[model samples]
Target: MSQITSPPRKARQAPVPAAGPDDGARARRVSRLKRRLTPYGFLTPTGILLVILMVTPIIMVITYSLLDGVITNKNPAFIGFENYAEVLTDPVFFKAVRNTLVFTLTSVVVHFGIGLGFALMLNSPLLGDRIKGLFRVIYILPWLFTVAIVAVLWRLLLSPNGVINYLLGATGLTEGQTEWLANPSTALAAVTFINIWSGYPFFMISLLAGLQGIPRELYEAARVDGAGAWAQFRHVTLPQLRPIIISMALLDFIWTTQQFALIWMTTGGGPIDATEVLSTFTYKLAFTRYDFSVASASAVLVLLMSMVLAFFYVRHQKSRD
Candidate 1:
């Protein structure tokens, strides 16, 4: 009876159905294939664009810069650094370098200061929303105008017997109408001012975004700790905003150093080369003097300088991070 009570042992069950070896292997292979393809799929477009737009032109520039005469139907004869040597020794090139540095440094400092001040002011409670928006639009309008239009407008304003002279006369600031652009001493300053006016809005908008990203709680905490406005800004805002400021300054320096249109339109690198920057000098070399090699060499130098600035900017950002 006891033996019978042990019910007949259940028939040996077949192993539960398991994933087939082929199916499991196929799925793993498919996943690995997709993982390998994903990165290439994303990079393909950018890689193609860089080769087409950037690498090709740079190769051409380097090749052309080595030649002696204008690159025409005839194959160019490589002159091995001749163009670079000539440019380096030229007085005009040296002058252009000096002017470029001055313009870049002045613009960077003025633009940063003015833009930061405006951003701070907009962040203040004294300025109502509507008023701040209105001012923002007005300040940004100059940036939207093309360089040619800005140059023409400023030329008219700075012309003899123009509105500036009229206003100055009315204010008893000058004896008579002055030719602002004709005077070499004042021409560079006038052009620099125009550049500052046109460029500062870009920095202002950038800094404003950076300012808005900062948390109000940080400021409140600092206040609770008996921090004054200057102390709070110094300890918190400046540190947080450092990266943005450095990036903007580097960009501004590169752009300002290569400025041509405003200088060309307003002064044509004249009042005796007073406003000649690298870009303008390159243009003059290429077009006016018919020296393509020199122009290319100058452009390459400018590019190298920009790269150096970029290197520093990247290093600074990495350190901060």
Candidate 2:
């Protein structure tokens, strides 16, 4: 056997197989699936939070609005749009709407004017950087304060025996102490002024950034074309800032209409409802009168109004993009 063994029969070895097209294709498909799922995996947490916090509350509020005495009544009966009808017909609601419009419009206009003026000053080449920096600090001081702080500060200042009264008396602007916050004739104006003071800095900062972004070449070209200062501002400056102005105005409109903290802390919509706004109206209905159903209806109406503004805002932003 040792002599005639055919060089020791080699053991048969199984052939190694080549990779198939199906294997490669399956790998590519797995890779593609991973890429697509990664983003969704990241967004899942945020989506869950939004659903829990925002969507859930909105649905609850809407449901409450359709019922009668939702929280107060043990068995809330579905009343369809009756609450809405009541809210729409109430004289106080109408008054609140009017006041809201007036307050919001006035604050937005004044905020724009003040913000533009400050932004212009800040952007002026005539001023030194140091001066600009100092002014910026001063201008932004109002915005640095929280709503609670601003409310308290303004209340003290506008009090009958406060510094403002003393100054008015000293300057002979008024002979006696004026009850600014307590008087019906002045309460609305007082709160409005306070709101303007606090809000203008937001517009100012935005406008200043916008002003800086305006190309100097445009102004130079305007000058070469014999455009005066006012003309240049009307054409070049206004045109350049138009987008920012519109965006800011719409945002301010939305924010001011929803203002509650400052109004609540400062005036509580008091002085015979002179300063009553939609937010305050809804709040009074819910907490003051314990009318949750009506308050929910009013809140839904406010949400609709805000949605309209938001729609325009989104459209404008898309156009710009």
Candidate 3:
């Protein structure tokens, strides 16, 4: 009876609840940790791919640059810096380098200029949204085409009897049918023009995004300060878009320097090497001349220049952050 009474007399107690400030804090800590790790977790696959694909190829190229003979020899000999020295002294390499620099600088200047103008037009509040959308689609259309396709299209147009020359003659812009891509003096310039046309769309898209991202308050503030269109563009727009411009310029320069398909398909580094760039030269060294070692060396040099630009870009991005 006593035992039964004791068991019955045990007081009822409420169940302990789980949700509290400490639980919330622990959950929040877990959330923060997940947030911190999420990006890296996502990036891991890409990082692995880059190392396997991009980094491995680069290392292979560097090793090849230091070695002599890839296909012709059974046991490839190590040439050390001899390839570098020879490549550095080669007049063809110099000419190619000069042409590449010229092409990159000229094309980038025109690209930025035209792209900036187009972006400003697109960003104008005077344009309705439908019109803006239409024009934007049109602007990006050229970029959708493959480089090889554009090269083929432009090759046809730049031929002596092609549509472009016909139009030029029809418009009285030229005296006669001219071999635009055949003439040594004009081949590089002609190719340059084609690239500019094909490339400006990319610049336009980038700058347009930059323009759209700009706070309208800045524009209003500028207006309050009695700033006109040009003034507002110079002080407000340019400053905000400076980083984009610089980054785009660096990327464009690197790309233009290494551009191959369009150039090879169009000019083939011909007209007495008038349109020769580092990339074309490298290809010719490897395939045409069957000199893989020299080609690798040249490729290494190009990679070095790209690395320098990439370094600057990384620094710029970090500083911006």
Best by TM-score: 2
The clash numbers for all candidates, in the given order, read 0, 0, 0
Candidate closer to the true structure by TM-score (higher is better), 1 or 3: 1
lDDT of 2: 0.96
Clashing pairs in 3: none
lDDT tens string, model 3, 203-255? 99999999999999999999999999999989999999999999998888878
Best by lDDT: 2
lDDT of 1 at 216: 92
Once superposed on the true structure, which residue ranges of model 3 sit more than 4 Å away at CA? 1-48
Q: What is the lDDT of residue 80 in candidate 2?
A: 99
TM-score of each: 0.87, 0.94, 0.85
Kindly provide the TM-score of model 1 when superposed on the true structure, using C-alpha atoms. Answer: 0.87
Model 1 per-residue lDDT tens digits across residues 1-321 = 354465577789788888899999999999999999999999999999999999988887777788878555376788989999998999988998998888889999999999999998887889899999898888789999999999999999989978999999999999787878888888888889999999999889999999999999999999999999899999989988888998899888877887888999999988888888888999989899888887888888888998898888788878978
Q: Candidate 3 — what's its lDDT?
A: 0.92
